[model samples]
Target: MTSTLASPDLRRRLEGIQLPDPLGFGTLMAPVMAIAHYRDGAWEDVRLDALDPLSLAPHTQALHYGQAIFEGMKAYRNLGTDLPGTALLFRPHEHARRFNRSATRLGMPELDEDVYVATLERLVSTLDALVPERQGQSLYLRPTMFGATAHLSVVPSTEYCFVVLATPSDAFFTAPISAWIERRFSRAGPGGTGNVKAAGNYAASFAAAAPLAKLGFQQLLWLDAVHHTHIEEFTAMNVFVRRGDTILTPPLSDTILAGITRDSLLRLAGSLGLSMVEKPVDVAELVDAIASGEDVEVFGCGTGAVVAPVELIGDETGLRLPLPPFPVATRLRRHMLDLQHGVLPAPAGWQRPVPTR
Candidate 1:
């Protein structure tokens, strides 16, 4: 409800926007946005403005050097009532920490967590009426920071800009997803930007993932860049394998995005008496186990999809992994959504409730 970068035109622009009947994932824009400029060695008054094109130099560092980082999170509405616009932010501080970590790795100034959290709360508060209340629906918030100065050389930009945009979306997974075990491409190198939600890392996925999409694959399971044998992660989600009472996931490395949903699942799995193993996952061993009649259940975890069971895993020479029902993933998935919507007990300080009049 509080903003320093208030513009009447921006508010008018947001008031004029309309959304589709079924707002698919990241498809419909919420008319309003929050933006703050960083220049002269400090961040200035952040503002709530209309979603519009930004004015940047032709040689902006983000456009050229790819110095951009972003985070995707959702805000829920109506915790105790069947009303719209309740706005519950899931584990927001962890995201704030990760955001600063990414900025430091990219050689940019770190963002203030207090400032970031406050800014998000303010934005969501003002835009509370736009938050969707339907099941499997919420306001998807995208917080992005980029170097904005005109720079040609390989150094960091002096100036930067951080913006948060929202989209009211339905469920990300309408059907069971089919993933191709990508042997040709690796999402990131050993010491690369894989852990961080950097824009370049996502752009790198397009060339390899596009081909798989052409072959009717919903997602690409990227392998290790060097060996092309170790399982890294799906292009966007963290993967987990279940063999009876044991839950196995690839340990956090420099090559995988540390998903918040993945972390929450691991935490809940511990309490549910599931043995957790975090190490390098060999893809060949995985297929071998699946073929050997191991009770294999494969699912992907992330904020967007929450928990999407993998229907099939295809590879060259016609290799497909058809997995059975994974109880752990199912239990975790239910627990996650339940807690997010106030069905189950809220974990220690997990949900940040929006103000209700």
Candidate 2:
């Protein structure tokens, strides 16, 4: 893979930056970023430059019309480490596939996967030391493409800019969480951008979720945007439930974000001797299962945090489902993290090591 832009100024900027001791998730930014612009019917040369505020025109289309998509991934320094620590990526290809899908859904051009992957490799290799080395620590990579042209009408912008930035941080969550089942606001409607990781989808959710934090709910369980009957996802993560040996998760409906971690979990379930089901799991059914003591565990999965077990599910009716005594979520989380950190034997081609030093 060849990078089009690499400068002494950018290298000096990277060397001059100082990161904190315990980097929090998405809090600390790497000093440099990779950017590429799409205009005039072609992708321009990829540029490596210092991380700085972007300059936008007075009427940028993305700012007004909300034409953008992004992807989140983690690169760990877990591979090739011998003494105590080794890092691994959970399922990066999954993110790549979804990222392109998001672009397609929003009327944006699909970035060539070869170019995308090569660009990712180049950036990861360049920021190798910034890859967190501790257990559960990683460099959170955010790749985003947004409309760059100015347009008053609702048409897609002809120009776009894609950039990749990294955030070095420890585990996103060291504890379980209590979530609320949002019965009022729907994250996506039928024939909407629910399945895609679009910027507007998240902006639409903030109106409903921001208020819930005051009520003490860590997150909201978004429903199917049409009828608001089924469980869709929580913020950007997918939902799952476990009953005995059978693992059940919401099906990949058009309104659901197909998570890489979700796919990895389903694949790993088989080898772990667990039965898996992918279908439209009703939120009411889940609440009933918890009330009747059938649902053993509940969790959410995404690139940020592989598995976050749900301790409570609060509803508008004052109902809360307490998670039953079972470490299925914990077990699965450990396995996934282990596979990512190289603590356990990795699946062939699941991880790619960074050659630094």
Candidate 3:
């Protein structure tokens, strides 16, 4: 990978761009992106360039074989932040580790963590102004890797491409969201790509999540693949439920994605005077606890969705599990956001500062 400085003309083009007021999630794209190609078993020519369409062969292996993975991250700018004018990226090294884990699972080449993180720093540093300064908005970064070879064979592609795109956006779920309990479809089974950020895992999830949009639900809650009795997670987030001062989430296994936000929350729960539990959560017990008026509050957390309270959990038959006021989630969300936007003093190496050249 190579580091090429942004020219003066490119900087002017980026500065001239304007972002709309709403700044919806994943809709608006930044003017620049970073890309690198993997060929002859080595990555080469990585550089920041214009975010333009790619000219690819018709038979790109990623198109047919689903050999692609991506990560969700964000960069925060200064306005409305405690450290004014200071830009920060939250735990980029953790994201890098997860990205490489996904790549290794797909039989793809693992990107060096240093190169992966430096690429993000270079991109955000060049386009720091594109990061939104709104309270719940920031520069959403997407780093994707795919098998770009045109061969149609079942073997792993010899060539791959890694690209990073940024978008200024708001929270994925702006308000409290309802989730549909998926019993008919399973996300993954034992020894599957459930832990990896494989593109196919999400596509397979659409069979259950897609229909929820029309049903007045915002997310789909997944259960274990073996018996469908244990709670796993959500479509794109990690699941957590609160009972009094205790927060519980399912334990990570080969069938669960170890979410970065989830880990941070578990680590921070003690500071919030909340106990943490990581065990196999049975669906029946969860439903019963909420129905018994135990003040059960459910929430989902991830990079894009961040901290979204699940207002209701229901199935197709119109059976809704009564939800309590999700105050715990709100407090936790604010705490994490404060740490991200510099309102609170973050833990050691929690937030990495960007060197704006």
Off by over 4 Å in 2: 16-18, 79-90
TM-score of each: 0.93, 0.93, 0.97
Tell me how candidate 1 scores on lDDT: 0.80
Alpha carbon deviation, residue 158, candidate 2 (Å): 1.0
Q: Which of the two, 2 or 3, has more TM-score?
A: 3
Point out where model 3 deviates above 4 Å: 79-83
Q: Can you rank all candidates by TM-score, best first?
A: 3, 2, 1
Better candidate number, 2 or 3, judged by lDDT? 3
lDDT digits (tens) for residues 1-357 of candidate 2: 235545667666667556677777778888889898898888887777788999998799999988999998888777444433333555666677889999988888877776776677777767766777676778888999999997777799999999999889876666898889999877877688888889898888788887776777787888876777788789868988787777788888778888888988888887998888997778877888888978478888887878888888898898877777658888888888877877777677788665442
- List, residue by residue over 16-131, the lDDT tens digit for candidate 1: 45657788887777778899888989888788887789998899988999999998888876554433346788888888888888898898877788778777787777676667
Tens digits of per-residue lDDT, candidate 3, 166-196, equal: 9999989888999898988999899999998
**Best-to-worst ranking by lDDT:** 3, 1, 2
lDDT of 1 at 300: 89
TM-score of 1: 0.93
Evaluated against the true structure, the overall lDDT of model 3 is: 0.88
